[model samples]
Structure formats: C-alpha cells, structure tokens
Target: MSTSPDRVGVPASDGSDTVIDVAGLHMRYGPYEAVRGIDLHITRGEVFAFLGPNGAGKTTTAEILEGYRRRSGGQVTVLGEDPEHADASWRARIGVVLQETEPERDLTAEECLQLYAGYYPAPRDVHQTLALVGLAEQANVTATRLSGGQRRRLDVALALIGDPELLFLDEPTTGFDPSARRAAWDMVSGLRSLGVTVFLTTHYMDEAEYLADRVAVITQGRIVAEGPPGTLAGREHAPAEIAFTMPADTTVDDLPDPVRAAVAESTSGRVLVHAESTLHILGPLIRWAEGRHVDLPDLEVHRSSLEDVYLALTNPDAHTV
Candidate 1:
C-alpha cells in the first residue's frame, strides 16, 4: 500500500517517446483472417485499451504485439524494437500478464514473486513489488489460500517483478468484486504514474473509460473506431435526451409547440425529447410548467454512454439512438 515514488530496479529512461507502433498489421489462421490491416500507436507512460467482443481479433492483435504470435504482414515496433526479432534485452523491457494463471499452490505470495524476480538481470525487491500491488499484507499467505482477486494481484506482481518499461494486462479484473475492481484500477493508475506504458485488453467498457487514455475498438477483424473513450464513434456529439414525467391532466396536446417539436417519443406517462441543444428544449419546458403552476417530475438529461457507443461500433446492426 506504499505509493512511494521510488521504484527499485527501474530502467533509466532511454528518451524514446513511442512505446508501441503498428502499421498495416495483419494476421491469418490458415484461410481465415483474424486481424486485417489494423494500425495503432501507443505512447510511453500512457494507458491504452483495446476493446472487442469475443473472437473479434482483439486477442490475436495483442498476442502479436506481445511477441507471442507472429504477424502475417506489416511492421510492429514495441519499445523501439521489432518484437519478432527483438533480443533478450528487448524482452526484458516488456512484461505480459496472461488472462489466467495457476501459480504453485504451496508457494507463499512472496516466494512466487522472488522466483520470478530471478529471471531479470535487475529485479524489483520482492517486498516492494508486493506493496506496489497492494499485496504486502498477504505476503505470507499460500497461493491456493488467497482469494481470486488476491491471486490476480499476484499475477500483476509477478509481471512487475522484472521492472518492465511496458506491461500488457489482459482482463486484470475479470472476477473481482466492485471494491476489488476499483483497487485494481488504482494499482494500474499507480503504474502509469511510475512511467510504465500499459497496453490493456478488456471487455468491460467502463474499465476502458476509467483507465485508458485512448482506446481502439475492434470488430470482425478490423478496427471500427479509435479515439478517447468520451469521443470514440462520436459519442460526445450524439444527441442529448431530456425526459420528464408528464404532470397529471397534461396531455401531449397540451405541450407547447416548441416542446412538442422536440419530442422523440413517450412511454408510461413519460416524455422524451431528443435534441442537440438540451438547454434550449429544457428552458421552454420548465417555463411552460411554471406558468401552469405544475412541476415536471423526475426530469433527467442523458447522453450516450461509453457502453452505448461501444456496442454500436462492435455491432453495426444495432441501433445507436
């Protein structure tokens, strides 16, 4: 639980700005193309999230970037070296956390970390790595005795033991409860503050919204949209909706002409107005209610959420509005 700025065994900054760069990337399994000509660039010390539904080629793309799989074509540079031909030193600079791991059941948490630490020429102190991932209190607990969330934290500790410049996390909070998920998010944010570039893959839209500096959404083996979570697929520009429960004895016909013009639909005694300018519609609606000495109940304004935009981008057949 220490937020100390000093991280042991961290490599000196090499002055490289770009952490990951991919151009015209493609991957094919036999005749089926899983990834088709996608391009992305991730900067140093930034959190980048890749989102997609199952079998959307997101996993395939991530594996290629991690050097676990070979690309069919295109150029990839991770940490200023091609992952395909990078040397041991290049591998030392990158860390990968798989979706699931089965650590030795009998080994204590600290023991597991110490085991992995020996793999690197310069490894972080086992105790410090435990604290960095919020696992210091559980250091002496056996791996099998720990909870699911605790085990996930151990996975991260193992990944960080090498003091990697770049870390790849695949669904780091898969089975976590709400509180645990928030803790994991805080850990990731701490990693970013320490100048580690994170390449994240997760199906959770809210996680991407909260953690990623930029996001790329993949569907049907291609990138459909790429931008900040707030603006991806123009979610920021999508129409705003003003909704309110109709006061008793106030029929749709009783609504003012300007208010009625903005009405998109109504259901269960509630009226929804869709407009680009929410205030323009809300102002008149409020004045109309005031003149009638009636209050508009349960008034609410809403914009497209990140989940809304993500679903629309991943599923073209789905309606956005």
Candidate 2:
C-alpha cells in the first residue's frame, strides 16, 4: 500500500472552544528528553485520543497536562489555565481516571462516590453518576468485592461526580471483557453529546477508532501523525484492492487492457488488482465480464484498516500503549 501521512497536530486556536491548547511542549529527565516539541489542540465536547508506543513520552506528556508533573519547557493550557500554575478552581473543572488506582476497599461504591462528591463544590447526583457508568446495580457492593470492570466503572463515576467539563481517561477499559469494554465505549461516546470534552489514551486501536473524533500519535517524544481515524496517516488514501476468482476458462490476456493494467496478480484461480482509482478499474472489469456473460460474484474491494496503517507507520516491531 502507498503511504501518505497527515501533518502533525494543528496549532492551538484562540477563537474556538479549545479546552486544551498545547504548543512546543517539552519534558526532560536530566539530559534525556522524554517529550519533544509536542503540539495539540483538543476542542470542547470532542473525544481526542493520544496514542503512542511505550517509552514514547505518552505518559510524561499526559502528566504535564494533568498538573502531576512539570515540563522542562513549553506552553501548556488546559481548561483555560496553565496547569503548572493553575489554582484549585481550575482543577475543579476537570476529572481524571488513571490506568489503575487502588479503590477504597473498605467503602461500598455508593459510599466512595459520596466521599469524593464532598470534595467537589457542585457534584452531580451520586445515583445519576452511578447509572451513567453502568454501576447503579453495583452501588452497594464494596470496592474490593466488585468485579474488575465494576471497579473501573466506579472510577468513572467518581470522575463524573465532579460535573467536570473535561475528563482524562487513561486506558479506561483495560481489564474489561469484550461486552464490558463496548459498554464503556458507549458511555464515553455519550459524554460527547453532553458537552463534556474527553482526552483518551488507549493501546486498543479499535477503541480509539470507535471513540475518538480526532487522534494524534506520539513516538520518540514527537507527534508523527494526526487526523480522524480513517484519515490519520492517510489510511483512507491507501490503494484499494479489487479481487475476484478467475473463471476456469479465463487468462489475463482475455481481459481488456484497462483491467489488465491494474492487475497485481492472476494465478492460482484468483485475480488481484491494486486500484489506485477504483472506479477506473471497476467499470472496465464489470463491462468486460458483462460482454462475456461471466459472473463476478466473488469479486471484492478492500481498503487498509487503521491497524494496517498504524503498523506501517510504527514498523512491525513497535508495540503501542
């Protein structure tokens, strides 16, 4: 497949509902710089995924944005304030769910949320938040007794209890089964319609594809690509494949020149065409088959999946997080 990549994260804007505006973000541990010149603009009510391989500065950048760590140099603003210097009010407007956190083992789901709700000046209704994360049934279960997925939902409920405008979800569905994970996805998807911005980080490509409106990939401390999932790294522009089973009596020479020109292979009872222009190839092939009264019933067209594009960009050896 041909390779084409989108430009890095666009410059942060001022005249929009941009919830997170970052520019030239850099972080260093001694002389080793973990995060390079990173740039991002996450708008309000959008689910934006930050993806990268391990040791790619993903966590470092997130911490800097979350106010848990200091960047060596760069401009960062989340919720309209510099997190490094922002006050309590700034923190109150956002919520965060880390990859893993020890829950309050002694407290029931309802009690834990009730305890955290007191910390927020205007928390959402405790029961409503529980229902939102699919945890209403488990509200009376102790955190230690609840299933893994249930605890994760409780974490989400805790985060939402603050009525936060922005939520940072890091690997939110890590321990979930297929059904549980998809349920979490639905909950996160609903957050967008409620005008809550989400900054999501996940290793699962399908999760990112399903949940994010836009995504950015960071590797070796810099963004390599940024765009919508289908268009990111120009996955949408990759060559299309047109394939069909070769009729018993057919040969490549029997096909019209236009169709023949597009064929990548024709042997072993199958013909494959790499279509740079799908219509150009399809029309001629269909007409050729019609003229011969041949059935193209087995024909199919395929595009590169997001995983295919990502592997191309990161190389087969790179493991994502």
Candidate 3:
C-alpha cells in the first residue's frame, strides 16, 4: 500500500485501526537471509513489544519498519504509507529513540531540544518535553555532563519534541539500573495515555511484561509466537508446578496413587509435582497427609513465566533456521 505525502494525516484505507502492517516480510544479505517471511501488525495507541535473542530477525524487522533498511520482499505500511518511499511529512509524524546517541558535548539539554524542534512543522514546548522525560532539572546541563540515565531521557525528549503519533523505541532502557528502568517504563506508559502508538524492541522479559499490551517473539526471521505476554505460547494454560518437602519416613512408593501420577522429580526430602490442575493432585495428597496428621511443608505452586515460554519457543532444536 502507498500513500501520497499530501495524505499525511489520513487514516488507513482498510478501515482497520492498525498503525503498522507487515505481510510476508523478509530481508537478505548476500546469500544469507536475515528475515524470513515474517508477518505482524501493530494497532494504534497500543504498546507492542518485539522480542528475540541475539542474531534473530528482530533488528532486521525493526529496521525495515523504521525505513532504515529496505526489505528483500514483503508488503509493509507504516501510518498508511510505504516506509521505503515515505516523504518528510510522513517522517514528521513518527518518532524514534535509538539504543544509543551522541549529542554535541557543548549543547545544553534545552538547546538540543530547541534545535530538533525546528525540523518539525509542529513541535512540543521544550520545557514541557523536558518535564515529561524527567529532565526539567537538568535542562541547562551539558549533554556530556549528564549521567547515562539522564542522557537516555534526553533521547526520549528529542524524539517527543516533534509531537509524533507513532514512536519506535529500540531498547530504550538497556543499561538502566532497576529504579531508572522503572522510571523509563512510566514514561512509556505516559506516552500510551497520550494516544501515541509505541513499537518497542527489547531483550528484557520483565520490561516487556510490564509495558506491552501485546508481544511477538521472532526467531530466525520468523515469528514463533504472538499474543499477550501472559498467554503467549499458551503459557497461562501450561502446567503448574507444586513442590513440597516430604516427611523423613515417607517414600515415593508409599504416596497415594494420584500423588504418584503427578510426581515429576524427587530428592531425599523434596518432591516436585507437575499438574494441570493443582486441586486434583493437592486434594488427594492433602487428605493422605491430614489422615496421618503430617504437614505438607513448604508447599508452593508456580505457573510458567514469560521467560519459560520464551526459552521453550526459541529452543535451538525446534528448527534449523
């Protein structure tokens, strides 16, 4: 799909609320393919996270959407225009926060924002942008003097100065301390409240879980799973693990038949049970324990985490690609 520069503010023709659309996208370098026919979409005013390990097609796919690298084959539309041929007006409607930046050492934060604001037809107030990014107190500080977290915030301020409708954030909080990362997350959440669509790429699992409305996992140039972080790869329905300390005199063979069926691992005093329904296994085990007047010590139940699902989906044995 193609949109003219004059149609900069127009909605998509398909009547869908999508801000980004990619179908059968692929990228190639010489004979090696970096992206292999991946299809995905991002809706308006939602935070969408793209996740993958190193050497996956995450970077290639993001670069294509950002208009940095042309795809080898696919159909892509960003804000109703083909990114490869989008014009300056189309560019103005989008903002990008790269993984790192190097601003002029001598420029103050306020001065830096002012300079970038001049490039857009309508820019946000410099002071307001600084405050939004928690850099209001550091407005006069030189770029070189700012701390790592402050510099990262400045990058976000620069991206927002143009009042963009769509924001692309590539690892926005890579080196942040825990507190700083949470602060950055708040800023991204604020952007969503202002009706800005965010396309995020990050390696942090918790970050994706906290900030994304939906997540897509890509591996070897193809998407292996896509859904809400909680349910990705059917994680919500995956088995729950029940672990407890067995009594000193207890043996695996002595346990009830139902309990034995659920047992997955056992050590000297510890037993691990994998069950689809905790109540099914716990009921029988509890009855046996109560009848004997013994305690089920240190019992704990845990469902699969996003990280667990991710590792499973991206397992090296899944496919050669």
Writing each residue's lDDT as its tens digit, candidate 2 over 56-114 gives 88778878888999889989999778999977666767898988798997999999999
Candidate 1, residue 180: lDDT:
97
Tell me the tens digit of each residue's lDDT in model 1 across 1-321.
Answer: 222344334345678798999999999999999999999999988899999888898778888988889899999998887888877777778888998778777899998987777767777889999999999999999988889888898999998988898999998998889999999999998997778899999999999999999999998889999999989988888889888989998887788888899888988789999978877888888899999999976999999899999988888789877
TM, every model: 0.92, 0.89, 0.88
| Model 3 per-residue lDDT tens digits across residues 1-321 | 122334334232455698999999989999999999988888888899999887887777888898989889999999888999988877888899887678767999999998888777777889999999999999999988999988999999998988898899988998899999999999999997778999999878898999999999988888999999999988888889989888768788878998898899998879999999888888998998888888976988888888888887888555321
**lDDT for position 87 in model 2:** 72
Q: What is the C-alpha RMSD of each candidate to the true structure, in Å?
A: 3.7, 8.9, 4.7
Per-model lDDT = 0.88, 0.84, 0.86
Top candidate when judged by lDDT against the true structure = 1
- For candidate 3, the 10 contiguous residues with the lowest summed lDDT are 1-10
Number of colliding residue pairs in model 1: 0
Judged by whole-model lDDT over C-alpha atoms, candidate 2 comes out at 0.84
Name the candidate, 1 or 2, with the larger TM-score value: 1
